[model samples]
Target: MGDIEPGALVLRRAEPADRTALAGTDPIAAAGDPTRRASIRRWCEQGLALLAEDSRGPVGYGVLEYTFFEQGFLTLLTVVPGARRQGVATRLLTAVEAACTTPKLFTSTNVSNQPMQQLLLKSGWRPAGLVHGLDEGDPELFYLCPSENLSLSSTLRTFPDTVIGKESRI
Candidate 1:
């Protein structure tokens, strides 16, 4: 599929039946990795997966879990190469945020993944922290999307003084 019309995309909770199609949408998963496939299956089984489809079929999927600091955490957000840069990831992220049950939703990407970092910032996610050693030279950059119920002051207090300042986006 080429650039998809935003109106044509449908977002829904992923099911076991969607595992194959979902995996097909991600290059890493489509490459036939057992671990990635199993992880997708587990996300579906736990009702933590959301799928984005158009008339063509499954185009993207996202996984959100409340396993980080007892808050919502977006573990995966993948879109097929053909269907990217057309708001598919944004829609998935919005759905995940709406489905989140906690006061804050968190997600992280490798520092080198500038595209994802840009998307997160553009979509209203604030920089939370940076973690090193996970991938050697490529550090992980964390982001936070606090719910309406969460106050900015509380969120700022949660991070180090250096992470939050007058110039901070949060």
Candidate 2:
């Protein structure tokens, strides 16, 4: 684990006990149904839930959903309202990227969510294009990391050796 801002925040693997925090504390709840909950549990089981915490408790969480496309997707990520701008989301993004060495990762955000767009760019994800009516007329901005750039061996050499193959966790 690493420290950012010296005692202001901590990043770590999220545990099963964090389920409630994820459901109730999320800044955006995608679907309020059993399916979403089940998916979250599956991510936790796969070791894909990474969280950010502070003096109080979990302030941010990111869940990744793996696909056969050789590229992984960040299915969900939320940072509690008050924790915005503290780098919580960034930490989670970094951890997830380290684990999933898919040469490219993909995530889409509503065109109106400028902050999400900014965050994605800040995390090194390149904007690919816009998917119109992606969610019933809600255009989503897509991002990608090319296969040539995501070669597992290259990323492993750039990142800590501990993260090598962690993509299999998903």
Computed on alpha carbons, the lDDT of every model, listed in order, comes to: 0.79, 0.66
lDDT of 1 by residue, 1-170 (tens): 88887467777778888998988987888999999999999988877898888888999999989889898899989888888889988877777776676778899999999889999989878999999999999999999985552354343422111212322111
The 10 consecutive residues of candidate 1 with the worst lDDT sum are 161-170
RMSD of each: 10.1, 5.3
lDDT, candidate 1, residue 42? 92
Worst 10-residue lDDT window for candidate 2 reads 161-170
Estimated TM-score for each candidate: 0.85, 0.74
lDDT, residue 160, model 1: 18
lDDT of 2 by residue, 1-170 (tens): 23335446655666777776676656334457777777666766666777667767777788766773757787777887777787777766665676565656777788888888898776667888887866886798888644444464345532222323232222
Candidate 1 overall Cα lDDT vs. reference?
0.79
The candidate scoring highest on TM-score is 1
